[model samples]
Target chain A: MNHNLPVLVLAFPLLAAFAVNLLGKISKKHVAPWTLASLILSAGTSLWVLKDVLQNGKFSYTVGGWMAPYGIELVLDPLSALMLVMVSWVALIATFSALPSIKKEMPGREHLFFSLYLILICGMMGLVITGDAFNLYVLLEITSITTYGLIAMGKGRAPLSSFNYIIMGTIGACFYLLGVGYLYLLTGTLNMADIASRLPALYESPTVATAFCFLIVGVWIKMAFFPLHGWLPNAYTYAPKGASVLVAPLMTKVSVFLMIRIMFSIYSPEYDFLMHLGIKNLVVWAATIAIVGASLIALTQKDFLKMLSYIVVAEVGYMVGGVWLANQEGLTGAIFHILNDSLMTLCFFLVASAIAYRTGSSRIADFRGLFQKMPLTMLALSVGALSVVGVPPTCGFFSKWYLLLGGVEAGQWEFVAALIFSSIVNAVLFYRVFEVAFSHSEEEPSLKFENSRILETSPMMIPPLVVIPVVLLVIGLSAGPLVREVIRLAVPAL
Target chain B: MDAWLFEIIGKFNYWIYVVLMMTGFYAMIRKNNLIKKLLGMNIFQTAIILLYISMGSKVGGKIPILDKEQALAGAVQVADVVNPLPHVLMLTAIVVSVSVTGVALAVALRIYKEYGSIDEDQILERIGKS
Candidate 1:
């Protein structure tokens, strides 16, 4: 079992999903705690895996003791271990916060929600840890299908949005499958390591190049990179408050991590395929447009959640641009941004869910005088907003700084400018919301304590909100250690 | 005639697959009906399955079941049997695609129940009116 920590982590939550359903049927009240307990166990296994990776370097676990190249293997490197921990950790908090909203939005289907949610965690873990390319496709489908179910749980327009997500997501996954098929055609193997080893001989072939393009495009669509991002805003905006908190922060991010893993691990960072075709420049330019364009689009949204969803689109640009910049700092920035952005988005989305829970609406107009009503919640929201705006002493600022430094090193001044411009745009967008929330109306005075009718949503919701921002601050302050100790180990040699 | 046989017949399977895949892609992207798009997604996935299964075939290859006599006598020649891995992989892919289609149709059903139409334009028009 110790040796099988990789599979155990997946099995713990997966098997527990059914157990949670059983508890929900028999007890109904015991389901949340059971889900949390299993997730905590999963998180513990993730940390164990992380510690082992950091101390002993990478290890691979073959299912049923079967050998690789023929049998499926789960690879636990520092990168995937870190992602496992992050996904589980955030998922744990998201589940805790979910109880309040799930009960409200989906009273009867609570077990079903947890079941799909746990399966999503299982699938994401499989996607991250699996060393085989085709296995990744299967795991990707599992995550996608479960997410569509979770999203459609929303009250209005959610089913439609989820339907849209299904179309795009299926196309993306199938494109990836097609690409894997091409890779198999050239190399006669579907294991990533095996394919990478055999690929150097075929690097100049058009089929290989086409396969690469298919993969990048597929990943881009899944990540919702700017032009391909149409399906994201609606799916996230209209999803049940509980569901968005779970799906928004992790799905696109894990997809981006898979992109990085595909490029760096399955295909070596120094493969030069990116540079040979000047695809790096193309991706970088697209990232630039994505940052600026998505920010502008974000500013136009009056719905608070919709606006943040657009910010998610813009932040996706940051990571994509950083990775495509093709320098060490850029790569580190991209990878680090994945961590920072997930935390930031989680904090903000939780805040959105909490406010929606209390106020019964998520529009900007609903936020009026919110600072007076739920001061602690608003404080948490302020931290998340400032982080998105790249203010210092928050995790977002450090990642943005690294991204800027990366852009400078790469001499991609346009991307650098876009990053800086996005920070300002984010600041303005958040400030606009703040202005609405912090205003003093006739009913709510500037210094009236407890005068407004607003109260904090619940004890459960504030913990994740406060805890996430604190984690953000800690990660921001210890940025050097995290980069030197964790991210660098995960990134392959350039 | 031999050249024609080797070239045309050799590549026609892939050509048919390309046609099938494009039709799926076209319907998925261009069709106004949600159900049609779902159908298109199915076509696209099936085309891919066909492509993989076809790639696993060899003209002279037999079924992948092991011959006990040959196994006892010597190491089996792999080229004598068609590849079985793609078949197994596509089995998984087909299961996944079926799940996707089921979930997609369910969501579409819900959408239709809510909006009274499954046409993309009508849904958009309805939303605009609302």
Candidate 2:
């Protein structure tokens, strides 16, 4: 009965996206509810897959009943199971909040908005599940193109940013495709598991070395690792509110998952070139600079949404540094941080979406007396803010702890310093927002929210904002069991 | 000297791809005009497609189609057919590149509409003044 779950999880979204577009022509109000029903169904299937993977161990589903190497397959394991559930649920919540914003921002075009939205989700899920290298590239482009369309829907400077995204995204995808081409030339296979089995024999070959370089660098560009992150902040910050909320959270995180998948799964754990060339340390060192520089830049941004984009860049550094630390603790920390970071970033971006919905602004100075006007929203924002600042009993704190330990274990003092420095900088960044929010209340107490339901935003937006912070806390508290039961299985064989 | 010349000639296809791809790469980074950058991107994608097509070629090989009667006779040889995998992959890739190009052109049109020009520096100047 559950055998078709993997393909169903992917196929449902593709079908729902088109269905939503068609339904939009008939009725505007139906788009969000229709999309929600389908999203919930897809999220449930993802959970079922997660449960199945946890129980029976890893399984691969061959599409169209064809065999592997000749046919594409979806592999569900503990890592992908974690990502699938996290991304699907977060996407559902984001879509829910997006309803109010879309109605306000782009009223007549609701169907097309949801259509691109659902396709982006499909691309991300497909990126996570596919076990074939070439299939991964195909899915990545689907995600990228949908993302470009979605970002182009933003108001002022969006189209230009979308064009910039097209350039960088195509280059990244092409580099990845070229790498896969070289791999096929050498290994004569495209299935990831087959490639891994055949690769050790060619490890010393220059062809294999070049292929590895192209593939990982391509993924780095996608994830916006330090030097390659030029397109991310401008593209995301200028994107429409709804697009930024979802893309800001899932896009880079999924790319990081793909990076991990490629490095450890397709190449085997003994990818000793990092050690032989000392490039692992070089990667981690680069990550350290990304953390420091992004945090400092984030601090200077007056626009809250733009600041969050830089924080996303810094968070990318955390995961990259942790993974490249090349130890069990570091790897576990990196994988755990992906889940933690996605939830928190979704929380943060959702609040930004809500802010844009209400005041029609996310400028920090424009938020005068927001604490009094929208107390609940500010409260939710604080939870997100504190998590990013690495406060305890929040999920971010635990992930940072593990990452710091990993840094120490690897004896990388520079990374250790960068992590601490960024956390402190993040604290200052959020506190400054709070200071501005509270600064106005002392003198004029802005418009009092005696009937604050207006401040609460539409009823549709509140549920996601309230529910996400609670989940953040729950995930933080249960992080221990999560590592034991789930993350341990997900870490690389290395 | 003869062997050296022959080896270089044998790898001529790869050298051509490298040259074409680099030309595109240079234009993408060095050009200030948006349309030129778009053209460069197209060139870059076309070069990669050509690289994949060349990889599928064989001097003595025919098309990759299988003969039904020859299969029944059990007399098929692998070397007789050029590799079809890269060709199939590149076909899908060409479609993707075309979609990317379409989206990019649409965005470029929008940029021109909004800012009245696609020169990177002028656009930035307009954005700054606003």
Top model number, lDDT = 1
Per-residue lDDT of model 1, residues A1-494, tens digit only: 26978888899899989998888887779778888889999998889889988999889998987799888988888888889988888888888788888887778889988899899989988888899999999999999999999999898899999999999999899899999999999999988989989998888788988888889889999999999999999999998888899888899899999888778777776566766536788889999999999999998999999999999999999999998887888988888898889888999889998887786788887677888778888898888888888888888988898899999998899999999999999989988999988886557543333323445876789789778878988998998899999988877678
Q: After superposing candidate 2, which stretches have Cα over 4 Å from the reference?
A: A441-453, B1-4
Question: What's the true lDDT of residue B98 in model 2?
Answer: 88
Candidate 2 local lDDT, A228-331, one digit each (tens): 99899889888888888899899999999998998888886686785553788899999999999999889889999889999999999999999989889999
Judge candidate 2 at residue B103 and give its lDDT.
85
DockQ of 1: 0.90
* lDDT of all predictions: 0.89, 0.88
Clashing residue pairs found in predicted model 2? none
Worst 10 residues of 2 chain A by lDDT: A444-453
- List the candidates' TM-scores in order: 0.97, 0.97
